[model samples]
Target chain A: EPEVTQTPSHQVTQMGQEVILRCVPISNHLYFYWYRQILGQKVEFLVSFYNNEISEKSEIFDDQFSVERPDGSNFTLKIRSTKLEDSAMYFCASSERDYGYEQYFGPGTRLTVT
Target chain B: AQTVTQSQPEMSVQEAETVTLSCTYDTSESNYYLFWYKQPPSRQMILVIRQEAYKQQNATENRFSVNFQKAAKSFSLKISDSQLGDTAMYFCAFVASNTGNQFYFGTGTSLTVIP
Candidate 1:
């Protein structure tokens, strides 16, 4: 089955640097999302992207965070300036439809901001 | 806002036995969907099963099944004849129909299948 794939399975960066996590969702999928989980915490929704624009986001998705489908296939999440608290496992997910469909999740990229 | 709650933080089931993981949610939206995802040691999210709020019939896949009670806002996953491979962290997720399709996930339940 087709699956969502992410690049740089692990990322280590400085606190003041910018980091862009890349994801390639299923080719025919319509909706894409970003979520993060602290080592022992619940997964928290970051943002959703569809039709080339952001569909929704949580309070944690502040101005420092931005998502863009730079190409028809590559979806990217850019953090302007990383923080230590930003260190977590970031996951990318996609679904063929908006509702009632199970979203396919990628293996996830573990980000460590020091 | 939608909130998914998984009251059980950890559980254990003997091999070949049946186990049920509880999940409940608070959602004002009538139209929504529920899902159970399994994450093993690899931490990869795998879709175990899904249930649509409008569907009265439960969803089952192989040894995995869901008991969805819409009126009570409860969705629980039942794993029959569990195996060692079934040991993993399970998360219950929810998404409202017209609410932009952002998934709300519960804390998660860690299950260990004992041999």
Candidate 2:
């Protein structure tokens, strides 16, 4: 089965620095999403992307966060400036369509902002 | 907004025994989906099973099965013949059927299968 892939299993950045998390979803998948989990906390939705644009986003997805499908395969989440509270495990997920119940999730990238 | 709740923080079962994790959700929409995901120490989210809200019959996957009661907004996962490898944190999730808006996830249940 095809799975979502993410690069840089771990990332460390200084406060106020920019960080871009990369993800390559399944080739034929049509929906992509970004979620974050603070240590020992529930996963929180950040944004969902489809048809080359954002479909929906949560309050946590403020101006500081931006998502773009720079290429046909690469989905990137850029954080304009990092904060201490921004540290968490970021996950990338994809599904064949917007209505599917199953979404393949990639091994999360742990971001540590100091 | 939909909210999934996993009231059990931790559970344990002996090897070869059966274990069930409880999950309850609040959603006004009748059409939706429920899922159970397993996350081990690696932190890789693995889909264990899924249940479509429209289906009345329960969903079963190998040793993993779900007791889905749509009217009560309850979905529970049962693991039979539990093994040491079955130890992990299980999360119950909810997603609307019409859109890829967001997934509402429960806090999580940590299960330990002891030999």
Look at candidate 2 and tell me the lDDT of residue B46. 91
Residue B106 displacement in candidate 1 (angstroms): 0.5
- Candidate 1: which stretches are off by over 4 Å? none
Report the Cα interface RMSD of each model, rounded to 1 decimal.
1.3, 1.6
The predictions' CA RMSDs to the true structure, in order, are 1.3, 1.3
Interface RMSD of 2: 1.6
Clash pairs detected, candidate 1? none
Clashing residue pairs in candidate 2 are none
Off by over 4 Å in 2: B97-99
TM-score of each: 0.95, 0.96
lDDT of 2: 0.92
lDDT of 2 at A107: 93
List, residue by residue over A33-108, the lDDT tens digit for candidate 1.
9999999888999988888888889999999999999889999999999999999999999989876678899989
